[model samples]
Target: MKTFLILSFFALAVSALPLEESERINGENGWYLPQEDGSFEWVDMDVAEKWMEAQEQLESRGLTTVPVKFYLYTSSNPTKGTKITTTTNSIDASNFNAANPTRFVIHGWTQSYTASMNKDICSAWLSRGDYNVIVVDWSRARSVDYATSVMAVGATGKKVAAMINFLQSNYGMSLDNLYVIGHSLGAHVAGYAGKNTNGQVHTIVGLDPALPLFSYNKPNKRLNANDAWYVESIQTNGGSLGFLKPIGKGAFYPNGGQSQPGCGWDLTGSCSHGRSTIYYAEAVSVDNFGSIKCGDYQDAVSKECGSTYSGVRMGADTNAYMVDGDFYVPVNSEAPFGMIN
Candidate 1:
């Protein structure tokens, strides 16, 4: 009997070993693959030249172009005992010829795609026409908890501020045109950047800002609109893992904030979590045809409402809300109005 009991215990222990090992591997691997030495080797002068050509094409169409500068940052995976390197790249206004163009920055969430990927995706928009777009690719350690991610965002926020200052002092860009756009965890990063900028930026657009972990109740010391005049817009789709509330100047929802078919709520689809092709096109349309009549651009929300735009939806409980009237301005004056609810 004693021997049988011992054998049973041994069997259970052996069975659990694989589970433990898998967990360890997951921790070591982080949420994504560790950056190999050759990861960024693909980026060089030749690639940059091609990128420049693409920018030129967009400029030919009267679109402003912003040059992209990729910077790498290293962080350790807490779960997996390995070192990972991530790159954060920024797009500058000099690439685009606007006297003093507004700076638009994008941020992503956990397991969010790499900055290079974002650069590739953003290139499409950059080629469309004139606009200064910057992407903040911060070091995102895999599976790093919400708190750790927030810290990373806060640190990057300082870096963004430095970059803005550099652009203003060296490149002669106006700080008033600066804008920040974040998705999921990137939304939290935008919040941090806005807090650090002290209201220098003109607007912030959050796409389905993560809920639960990165929600408004998370006690973020760096979360708040820096200036009363600073406009913030939040659009949530699918069930993001945060405690979302109506805080921005205008919070628009297309399908009542539920995940759409084309927009990948997580990462398992044609489009990642950040910006979907459908959402991108919709955003472009909104930028072009939306209205800005309301005090904080509430009219813009109405413009995007009821359209068959593609993107993830937060859930059934979510509804679009706007805090101010002048959040979004219409690009085309002749476009129809009174559609969005």
Candidate 2:
């Protein structure tokens, strides 16, 4: 028993997202579904990069064409709270109130609804109080190979944007209160969503935006300052899995954004990458990471960033205008990494 229906009414106006048919691209080397001709093939990282480099017509095939799924939660524990579902082409948010603050938490490659940082972030935000938390699980569009995930990001971003736009226009959702959070590859995904939204998205938080096949690329193709009114980036693993450049107007390079304090010598190169979510979750409890303004990594490493300018806290609660610049935040490397000044 549900009374409301979506996508059915707005079907005609949204031709950009053709929900009728969602066909994933296929190739040879990494990961893919079997084709109609009973052929199975995959593409390696190099081949995947080539596909990403290729010029596509319009990006993400326009909305619902990729079949993105949204899971909504208002409380920290989803088991105790009821869930609201929205399809790739619809905004069937029945119990949700559009006036309140909304946060869209997107997962990275090979991650599912419950697999990664999105859930932690949703819980952290809800633990504070009641808020709309939409966990975007785009598993249908994701594959085992990194390149496929990279190639699929554009289309995925569009659908997320379209869904938000539809909610804003039809349900009276406020765009100014919307915040998009994405980690690793999902970070770039949030950037695209913010970029495509109708009246300008309020904020976008990028936690260690994926570096491979994305960095040193065009601004439109990846996360950047223009994506939202206030774009904050928390970089954890520089030049490896996470990006090295400053994509956010408020960029915080924690401990030089690499070689996190507690990982030890064992390095598959994702420890610091995962730390972004951990630090972000803690920040949600309260942006207590007393980050200081600095000229660059050299100054920060020399303990000079803290002396030049007044320290600013990092997280969702940060005031955009008050803390807009490149910053450096020191961390413990273990749980409860950041300490307040």
lDDT of each: 0.40, 0.69
**Candidate 2, residues 1-341: lDDT per residue as tens digits?**
00111122123224334222234322212233222233333323344344444424323343223557777777544533334443423345344667668889888866776765776788788888778888888864355445445666877898789878877877788888789999887888898898788988888999988766564446888989889989999988766667666778888877877657787763545678788888999899766787778887556444467543356777847556676777778888677888687
Backbone clash total for model 2 is: 7
lDDT of 1 by residue, 210-319 (tens): 54323343335324554223434344333333223444544444323333333434433213233322343344434322322332223333444333422222111111
In Å, residue 64's CA in model 1 sits off its true spot by 37
Itemize residue pairs with steric clashes in candidate 2. 28-42, 28-43, 29-42, 29-43, 30-42, 30-43, 60-155
Off by over 4 Å in 2: 1-50, 55-65, 76-93, 140-142, 297-309
Candidate 2 whole-model C-alpha lDDT, 0 to 1 = 0.69
Structural similarity to truth (TM-score) of each candidate: 0.50, 0.78
lDDT of 1 at 11: 49
